[model samples]
Each structure stands twice: as structure tokens, then as C-alpha cells.
Target: EDQVTQSPEALRLQEGESSSLNCSYTVSGLRGLFWYRQDPGKGPEFLFTLYSAGEEKEKERLKATLTKKESFLHITAPKPEDSATYLCAVRGSYNTDKLIFGTGTRLQVFP
Candidate 1:
């Protein structure tokens, strides 16, 4: 079965701390994998989309990368404003219209 799993269900970090969030998946064929940042009481905000292994995307303090079976979201010197739940979703070739999403890693950055 195709599935996505994220580790460290929650993360607490001091301002300017750096860390990496993991997203692993097992699918028949990968079409695209996505990253999103969602704040409380709001919809997810798109971050990146990686289509194949070795692909990467970056925006400000966030960098996302993809491998053959997993993806990673790296936070660099995060600020309090970066606190949010980081979500990972995938689109498999078997079901192009559907997306499988992980439970997400809730990140809290404190000063």
C-alpha cells in the first residue's frame, strides 16, 4: 500500500534554530511530492513541489528536497514567524487526481 509518514509529530525550537523534517513514502510510482506550511485556523500555504529524485526547491528559510522514497524539509535559522505545521503530500501515478498527505509535523519556534 502507498503511504506517507512524518516523524517527530511535534517539534519545538528556539529562534534561529535549524532542523530537518522527514517525510517518507511507499508508492507504486511517484508523480509529484509537495510541501505546505499551514498556520492554525487557516488553509495550507504551498511551499514546494518536487517531481523526481535529486529535485529541490527553496524559499527564504525553507528548503525542500526529494529522494527516490522520501522528502525532507530543511529549516534554516527559523524565526518565530516560521512557526507552523509543515505538511507533506504526494501524488502517485496510479491516482493522479488524488493526494496522500502525512499527518504533518507541528513546529513551534520561540524567542
Candidate 2:
């Protein structure tokens, strides 16, 4: 079975605080790793895609990296407006348009 799991369902951070969130997975032949950020009552916004090990992507204060078995999303110097839910999904060789998603990590940045 293909699956994705994210740690620390919710995180509280002070403005300018930096931290990293974990995204673990178990899948059959990973085609891609996707990262998304979702705000309250809205759809997820695409963040990054990792296709292979050692590959990394970044935007603003966010960085994503992938490995053979897992991926990570790192947040740097977070601000209050950055508070949102971060979701991870995996595309497997056996599934088509069926992205296996994690529960998501909710981040709360306090200014």
C-alpha cells in the first residue's frame, strides 16, 4: 500500500523562528513527491515537486528535499502570515491521478 504521513499535526512558532517538518512515506515505485500549502477553507497551493533522491526545491522561506524513502519541508524565519497547513502527496507508479496524501502539518506563526 502507498501512504504518506506527516509529523506534528500542528506547530506553533514565533516570528522569525526556523524549523523543519517531516514527511514520511511508503510507496511502490515513487513517481513524484508533491508539496502543497493550504489556508483555511481553500484549496492547496502547489509548492514543490521532487522526482528523485537528493533533489531539492525552495521558495521564499520554504525548502523541500527528497530521499529514497521520505521527504522534508523546512521553514525559515516564519511570519504570522505564513501560518497554514502544509500537505504532502505522493504519486506512485501503480496509481494514476490518485495522489496519496498525508494528514498535513498545521503551522501557526505568532507575530
Candidate 3:
């Protein structure tokens, strides 16, 4: 079976606090790793895609980096507006491009 896991199911941070979220997986033929931010009751917004190990991407207050077995999302001095659930997914095969998603990390930034 495909496997995806995220650590620290939930996190609470004061405004301007920085932290990192982790996503780990064990899958065969990893095609890509994707990161997304999902607000309450809303669909996930795509953040970055890491196609291979050693690849990294950044935007605004967020940076995503990938390794052979896991990935990390780094938040740099996030604001209250950054509070959301962060999702990690991996596409394992080329047949259909299906994504197996982790449970997601819940982040709350307080003002």
C-alpha cells in the first residue's frame, strides 16, 4: 500500500513564529512531491512541486525542500494570515498520476 505520514498533527504559533513541517513517505517509483496550503472549508492551493531529491522551491514566507525519502516545509516568520492546513502528496506512478496524500499538518498562527 502507498504510505504518507506527517509529523506534529497540529501546531500553534504566535505571530511571527517560524517553524518547519515534515512529510515522509514510502512509495515505489516516486514521480513527484507536491505541497499545498488548505484553508478551512476550502480546497488546497498548490504551493510547490519537487520533482527530485535535492530540489527546493520557495514563495513568500514558505520554502519547500525534498529529499529521497521525505520533504520539509519551512515557514519563515509567518503571520496570522498564514494559518492553514498544509498538505503533502506524492505521485507514485505515471499511469494515472494519482496522488496519495498525508493527513496534513494543521498550523495556527495567532496574533
Candidate 4:
């Protein structure tokens, strides 16, 4: 079985603030890890794909890093426009394409 857990269910930040969100996970057979950002009512937008330990990816104000048992989403200089729910998902080697998703971390940035 594979599982993902995100900390700080919600976060509030003033404009220009930077913070990091944690994602802890466990999987039977390691495969791949993914990160996404979703708006209030929209589907998750792809952020990154981590296939090996020590792998890292970034986009704009966000950076994602992966390890054997966990991942991290680092947000830098966040603005109100950056507010959204960040999600993490992982696929195990045994699974087809189905991914186990995390509940998500809701981030609110205020100006």
C-alpha cells in the first residue's frame, strides 16, 4: 500500500513570505512522485515529477524535492496570486497509472 500525508493543513502568508510544505509518504514498491497546484474548483495542474531519490524540480516560485520516503514543496516570495491548494501524488510500481493523492495543503497569501 502507498500513502501520502501533508502537514500544516492550511497556511497563511503575507505577500513576499516564503515557506515550505512537507509531504511524508510510504509505498510498497517505489515508482514516481508528483506535485500539483489546484485552484478552488479546478483540477490539479502539473508541477513536477520526481523519479529518483535526490531528484528536484522547480517552476516559478515553487520547488519540489524528493527522497526515498518523503517530498517537499518550497514556496518562495509568495503573493496573493499564488494562493492555491498544493497537492502531492505518487504511483507505485505495481499500480498501472492510478496515483494515491494527498489531502493537499491549502495556502493563502495576503497582500
Runs in model 3 deviating more than 4 A are: none
Whole-structure CA lDDT of model 3: 0.93
Q: Which prediction has more favorable TM-score, 1 or 3?
A: 1
Per-model TM values vs. the true structure? 0.96, 0.96, 0.95, 0.95
lDDT of 4 by residue, 1-111 (tens): 678999889999999989999998898776889898999989899989998889999889999998888999999999898899999999965848889999999999999
Worst 10 residues of 3 by lDDT: 90-99
Q: Residue by residue across 13-77, what tens digits does model 2's lDDT show?
A: 99999999899999888899999999999999999999999999999999999999889999999
In candidate 4, list every pair of residues with a backbone clash. Answer: none
For candidate 4, the per-residue lDDT at 49 reads 92
Query: What overall lDDT, based on C-alpha atoms, would model 4 receive against the true structure?
Result: 0.91
Error of 3 at 76 (Å): 0.4
Q: Which ten residues in a row are the worst by lDDT in model 2?
A: 91-100
**Which regions of candidate 2 fall more than 4 Å away from where they truly are?**
none
Decoy 2 TM-score against native: 0.96
Worst 10 residues of 4 by lDDT: 89-98
lDDT (Cα, tens digit) per residue for candidate 1, span 1-111: 779999879999999989999999988878889899999999999989999899999999999999998999999999999999999998865846799999999999999
15: Cα error in model 2, Å: 0.6
